[model samples]
Target: MGFGSYDESEQDNQEYDTDFEDEDGLDAEENAHEGDIEYEFTASNDELLDRLEDIKDNQNT
Candidate 1:
């Protein structure tokens, strides 16, 4: 056994308790979501571009 050498028989066996009885306390069936998402944007392309330009211009000041 030198600097970085390790004996195989010296290491202990590791066992983990992988049993997580609903971690975060939310059941899979209860957290299930079914819905239709709709997004409505009131700003036009020109307006959005203008706002973005304003943001960039303000960042320089």
Candidate 2:
């Protein structure tokens, strides 16, 4: 066979070590809550409507 040729005899001799531990503590299944996210929009309804109207006018032009 060539250099990269696949051999059926060599497949049976392969050994893999599946026993291993993660260095970080993330291996265990645990849920860690970070914090709650809060958002506040200061724009009024009239201001938002005006902005939408301006966008529509600019797109038409």
Candidate 3:
């Protein structure tokens, strides 16, 4: 009558162990590099406008 058969007694004797020390080490390494990279666009507004004009001129030609 059901889609599938599931036995609950099979899982009554199983043990699951999870360790967090390894995960904590990985998180610490990731946090250390959080401040290492500086994310910023160094291009000025005038420089960007000039590049856009150059592209437009090329497309027209």
Candidate 4:
């Protein structure tokens, strides 16, 4: 006997629709933002290289 009385097929469909409707889809769209905000991050070449090295070392260890 099953643990609960609810049907499995109906539950699966409800969960599927909820997942699709809730997705933001920002990353998937070609031009999702359309220039709402401007963001920038700048650093010297040496500083960028140092950060890269730190990341590599962390991954190796």
- Displacement of residue 57 (Cα, Å) in model 3 is 0.3
lDDT of 4: 0.75
Candidate 1 at residue 56, lDDT?
Answer: 100
Model 4 TM-score (2 dp): 0.39
Candidate 3 wrongly placed segments (more than 4 Å): 1-39
- Model 1 TM-score relative to the real fold: 0.41
| Whole-model Cα lDDT of every candidate shown, in order | 0.86, 0.86, 0.79, 0.75
Model 2 clash number: 0
Residues 1-61, candidate 2: write the lDDT tens digits.
8898898999999999877667634744467667898989899999999999999999999
Off by over 4 Å in 4: 1-31
lDDT for each residue of candidate 3 in 1-61, tens digit (9 for 90 to 100): 3678767787898877666576555565555654476678899999999999999999999
Which ten-residue region of model 3 has the weakest summed lDDT?
26-35
lDDT at 13 for candidate 1?
64
lDDT of 4 by residue, 14-56 (tens): 6334555435555566656665777576988899899999999
**Model 1: residues with Cα > 4 Å off, grouped in runs:** 1-34
Per-candidate TM-scores read: 0.41, 0.40, 0.36, 0.39
Candidate 3 has an lDDT of: 0.79
Error of 1 at 60 (Å): 1.7
